[model samples]
Target: MEKFIGLVGTNSDNSTNRKLLQFMEKYFADKAQIEIIEIKDLPIFNKPEDKQIPEQVQLIADKIDAASGVIISTPEYDHAVPASLINALNWLSYGIFPFVDKAVMITGASYGTLGSSRAQLHLRQILDSPELKARIMPSSEFLLSHSLQAFDEEGRLNNGEHIEKLEGLFEDFLTFVKITNQLNHAHSINKKEAENFSWEEI
Candidate 1:
């Protein structure tokens, strides 16, 4: 089965975002292998003079670099992506590029009605940066509103419509991964450019 990295975009202990990815890991067990990665306890990013990548960060980068695709689940904080996710990405990108030309699916959970819409948009912009260059799945948005109640005791989605939507998006992502593989002729170029690109220099 094709493997995908599931990024829990928070360091919170009781994050619904983590729950969302966990649900996907089980729900899509028959179709794909989803490995959920946590971003907690990592030190904040400091521009290293030697450009050395941290061991944990390198491990995460390797997983993402080897995966078929990625699923990033985020929760809105102050109408933006949380700082923890940003910090993680900062570590993953500094002198190491794992997201270049990689297929990504973004999901977000919110307590309010908007369902982390702003955060998702912000994350999309971040991934679109030259240093990242992630090929995010187009025309797709999975928002889990009132996410605290969206799941059941068994961690399965309670709403039938939500399940149906997730199913369709999951299928689309699988196809997107396949298409991304075919479009990798430019991947090396992108990776080189990203590696050379530096946020601090710019």
Candidate 2:
């Protein structure tokens, strides 16, 4: 019953990041339910003492809360992620506390020499808030310089090695979700015993 959510950061219909997401969608199509989180319908976050949460923001939070894991895809602008993604996280981190303990992975595309390395690093820092349990792939590394030509003219990844890398990353991420879900299930079965089970025991 684990659900996977893909949070796409760019607002462009032809975004290269979105194309990457689409490739991911295909790769994970049979593994779990994948929900694409779009930024087009969201509004900027606002902190008001008397205002209620916006419907759009609440909708996003509800989805995030319901999903078991999330994949964050974005574009790097000025050495950081897009404003849309920042705003989305802002909404989730409002007094509502939407991202708590949510497993997350981030990926991006950039035209620069460094690719999206700086932007992804900044994203890792921002998402390290107390509410979220974001998990990133250290070895999967960055995909930037060749990202422009990595995809075929039809927008699909044409390189066999890159596709294999993505598949491996996806498998690893799914394993993470499975392990966490098992732990949660174990805790539910017997909270005390689950707590007592040592890491070596696991």
Candidate 3:
């Protein structure tokens, strides 16, 4: 089964973004496994301390490495991505590079009008950095604005339009993950073959 890591960008117990991720986990349960990764226990990134990676950080890194793709649910803070999320990415950037060539889909929920759109854009830039190099979904973004009223009492998204869009985006993202995995597998095989090639054999 294809596994996808869900990164919740907030530390709040009542975070709307967390709820959003939960919905996604259930929605995609049959298609792919979505494991929500908690960042609360991760220590702030430090260069010197990175030589001996923290156990929590290593554990999350291992999960990311094993997953076929990632989905991040973020909440905008002062028109920027949450510091907790950025800190987690910073840790991954140092030596892990778990995001390198990994397929990622970004979504967010906010009480504002833009639905964390600005924050998602900022996140895309960060993921595009040399160290991270994540491959994000190209066309659609799942943004839930006015999120307080977006969900029903049962915790499912109430807006039919939003649900339709999310379904489409998820389908596209799945295809993207499959294609990326195939390409990466082929690249690894080619690299191994080149490594074993000898001039005497040629």
Candidate 4:
């Protein structure tokens, strides 16, 4: 099956986080069809009781709905994930809940030694819910400390170990997606069976 990956980057232009996402794209070039979603294009989350959703928000929801899995490459801003990311999540959770039952993975990088750890933690918290099925890697495993020293001019991950780690994460994400999709299929089948069953005389 073709794996549909949605890459969400919090930057508008060239950024370390975007570079890292590009690297992942290269790694999964042939195996998956990757779609890049820019936070810059999205508007702030605004909820009104009787108002319709904006076209941009609907566009994002459609992308999330179409994707099989989501990979968020977030940057830390003042020791937290960007407001744009949070805003996007808020919009997604309001009515669409596009994240529900979706497989997700998060990787972060920064110039600081902590390497976006705080941001990743906050993201995990925000995304924590019964409906949002995510397979998050440990903080220790998904880090890019001193990212400026690690990547090349063409936005490639130079460290072989880091590349290997990312490849492993991608594999794990794919596995998780496959399992979840299969479970959904099984659930549908069971529901049909239950609904189609007829009453019998004892």
Best by lDDT: 1
Model 3: residues with Cα > 4 Å off, grouped in runs: 185-202
Question: Model 4 misses residue 139 by how many Å?
Answer: 7.5
What are the per-residue Cα lDDT tens digits for candidate 3 across 40-126? 778987765536778888898899989999999999999899898999888886656677788999999999889999999999999
lDDT of 2 by residue, 42-127 (tens): 77777666647788888887888788888888788888888888887777766555454556777777766666887888888887
The candidate, 1 or 3, that scores higher on lDDT is: 1
Score every model by TM-score. Answer: 0.97, 0.81, 0.89, 0.82
Off by over 4 Å in 1: 199-202
lDDT of 2: 0.71
Output the lDDT of residue 54, model 2. 83
Error of 3 at 96 (Å): 0.9
| Candidate 3 positional error at 92, Å | 1.0
Name the TM-score of candidate 2.
0.81
lDDT of candidate 3 at residue 29, scale 0 to 100? 87
Which whole-number lDDT from 0 to 100 does residue 103 have in model 4? 65
Q: What's every prediction's RMSD, in angstroms?
A: 1.0, 7.0, 6.3, 7.6
How many backbone clashes does every candidate have?
A: 0, 0, 0, 0
Ranking by TM-score: 1, 3, 4, 2
lDDT for model 3? 0.85
Worst 10 residues of 1 by lDDT: 193-202
